[model samples]
Target: MSSLWEYANPLKFMRTTDWLLPIVAVAAVVVTTTGLIWGFFFTPDDFRQGSTVKIVFLHVPAALMAINAWLMMLVASLVWLIRRHHVSALAARAAAPVGAVMTVIGLITGAVWGQPMWGTWWAWDPRLTSFLILFLFYLGYIAMWSAIDDPDTGADLTAVLCLVGSVFAVLSRYAANFWNQGLHQGASLSVAPGTRMDWAYKAPLYTCMVGFGLIFLALVLTGTRTEIRARRMKALAARERMA
Candidate 1:
């Protein structure tokens, strides 16, 4: 536990990420590119959905990261509130835009995929609606952070907002199950041996998922380091003024 908390220090965090960031970035690029090429070009067209099925390579991973990123922020918010760790708050802030971008990717890909199947570009489906609301929450969280002058105060308020928004995040994932009447389909990836997706699709899909996760990690680490550096510069400027 103590070792884990050591990363909360800005210098230590920066040091650790210095070596880790490039590896994650390179892995993300390689894995995502491979999965996309494999899924799009090499795979057979679905008998029903045809080539449109290839969009799942982008949609599923983006949707998964969209939700998971918020969960990551929620955990960070809790850590900041409990431990007063500035790094945690900065990390949550860093994650918001990444989550928002993932949400947009999910929404756009979903719309593109749905048009051929659902005959419409948009729907008020349970899962889609909740995911949209999650996007709004991400925007709101970012706005709230920027609106305040004091960093700590902003972090506190945003943490509360994160707690409130978590309800929608939960609903976003399970809303289809609870409502039982929605245009959205069930999860594409599953642990069962005989899952809905064939191994051909599942294998590349899994690769994409891992790639997206690493991409998210790399972005957050980069963003958090930027924030830490900015904070340090501000502190130094203040010291210079005092001197």
Candidate 2:
């Protein structure tokens, strides 16, 4: 257990993360492949919406993760800000892009699905507007990271931005609750009298979420490792300059 726990420290983490990369990568591939094949082929069509509704399996989960990922970064950033943990800071940085990608996926998929179901593809409905705000938060967070010259300063700015973003995510999730009406129907799976999803659809939806999550973990680790290496190289070069 002690040996296992040491991996939290940067030095020990360096020794272990590379070994786990292949394992996580393989799991991501297997889950994604199986989930997509089953979801695309075997899942039953929606009674009302028909085939277009299939996009929900992808869109809903990605939207869920996008919001959740920013929350994760908020927590990680808080820890980094308070405790000054390098790994936590790196993790916050790495998670930003993944969350942004997931947000884009959700928005694009939702738009595509809406065209056939709703008369128009776009609407300034509460849910849609709040989600757009959430997407902008992701962009702002990424931009803060890139704008600063000192990486530590960038981390601090982005951490504060992440905290603010978490607040927005909460607002986004609840925006529908506040509104008198919504373009989105209450979730079938998540709400009361939950969706009657067939087993085939349920299985793949969960598998895909798991697959995407693993992919996120793998990418975060890879980015952290690279950040560490880059820092080390910079330090060594500085030492040579001094020598």
Per lDDT, the best of the predicted structures is 1
Native-vs-model 2 lDDT?
Answer: 0.81
How does residue 230 of candidate 1 score in lDDT? 79
State the C-alpha lDDT per candidate.
0.93, 0.81
Among these predicted structures, which one has the highest TM-score? 1
lDDT of 2 by residue, 31-77 (tens): 87777777778788888889886787788778878888888898889
Clash pairs of candidate 1?
Answer: none
* TM of each candidate vs. truth: 0.96, 0.90
lDDT of 1 by residue, 65-135 (tens): 99999999999999999999999999999999999999999999999999998999999999999999999
Task: Give candidate 2's error at residue 101 in angstroms.
Answer: 0.6
